[model samples]
Target: MRFTEHEMTVAVDTVARRLHAATRPPWRRGDAVAAYDGLERMKKWRLKVTAGEVVLPVLTALPERPTVGAKPEFTEAELTAAAQTAGRDVMEHRKPGAWDAMPAKRRDRVLATAVELTRVAVDGMPVRQDPDALIVPDHL
Candidate 1:
């Protein structure tokens, strides 16, 4: 999900413009102007893409019950034990696969899904205050 070269260029330009814009409130804000200058001086700023990583949130295809095709009906205790084992399996570690080596079409789909899930999770989060108010300074 790391942006392609073209995307990176556009994003950097947009961010630079926004930072420059932030310095222009009617207020006498020295810090805002300084920060904007500092950002311009930076030659490199890395933007990580979490969607590039494998092991994305899976919303389907849970394991089938262990007793699905059992020859004999299991006792209540046995069923309870199976459920506990399944719960523990959820906490097990699964190693990451080679996402970069995947086919372009498949990788695109996976990254797209990850981005959508990320958007949903972010949208559902609760904020203590309005973000715009905190990010932008008021005029004096």
Candidate 2:
């Protein structure tokens, strides 16, 4: 799938947050870090081996962006608490200025190049009804 910059950023950050949480001493027994790490690796591999139509399995890997104009799900108190938790997470674990260093266009371009390289690689493989389909892992 062709992900927008916002979508990819949200996904990456979300995963990073979960990773951070899981790595803490109290949460180390849980599976969140392993799952997110696997997903991140899978995305990189899929991006490396698909062309033209890059349908990533990450469609369900991360939460969707909250819709605008939707009824609020949390009371003001709950929202405030949640924000405080997230802010703490960000302040300590998130790499400072990582987002600024990677422009969305550059990331997309890199993905595009990977797809192009996959197309070249697939040319020599046995023809299939859908060349890209071969790249999608059966286990998603």
Candidate 3:
């Protein structure tokens, strides 16, 4: 859906916060590193969007889903459907025709990113202890 720059920023920030919280005490080192990298990229995109360098700051590549040893709570199809519903809910709140105005590629990219992010968030292991104790190295 087409969004104002401010709206997009808010949406990005919302998703970023969700991801950061979910990945704070990452299930694995690699997951933490990937989450950090994705957050960094999102930060850069936010800047570019604010500067008008990019109309939509959708990620070109989807975030990698974490591998869980235990049985997943949701199936892949369920997650995909949930993500699409979430995306649609967000779009439905916007002005009519705005979503349709966005190009198909942009819409698909946005949905893909959303779905990947949701999957990553949901797949993260539950942390019982304080997440702040674990420090992910910046270099990673």
RMSD of each: 19.7, 18.9, 13.5
Worst 10 residues of 2 by lDDT: 52-61
Candidate 3 lDDT, 1-140, residue by residue in tens? 22234444444544555555554774556554456466667674654343221122222122233333342355556655555565555466666566677788988887676666544433442422333467679999
Worst 10 residues of 1 by lDDT: 52-61
Model number with the top TM-score = 3
How many backbone clashes does every candidate have? 0, 1, 0
- Over 4 Å off in model 2, which ranges? 27-140
The most accurate candidate by lDDT is: 3
State the RMSD for candidate 1: 19.7
Q: For model 1, how does the per-residue alpha-carbon lDDT over 25-103 read when each residue is reduced to its tens digit?
A: 7575566535545653333232122221211122111232323222123334443343333323333434233443457
Q: Which is the better candidate, 2 or 3, if ranked by TM-score? A: 3
Q: All candidates' lDDT scores?
A: 0.36, 0.39, 0.48
**Candidates ranked, most accurate by lDDT first:** 3, 2, 1
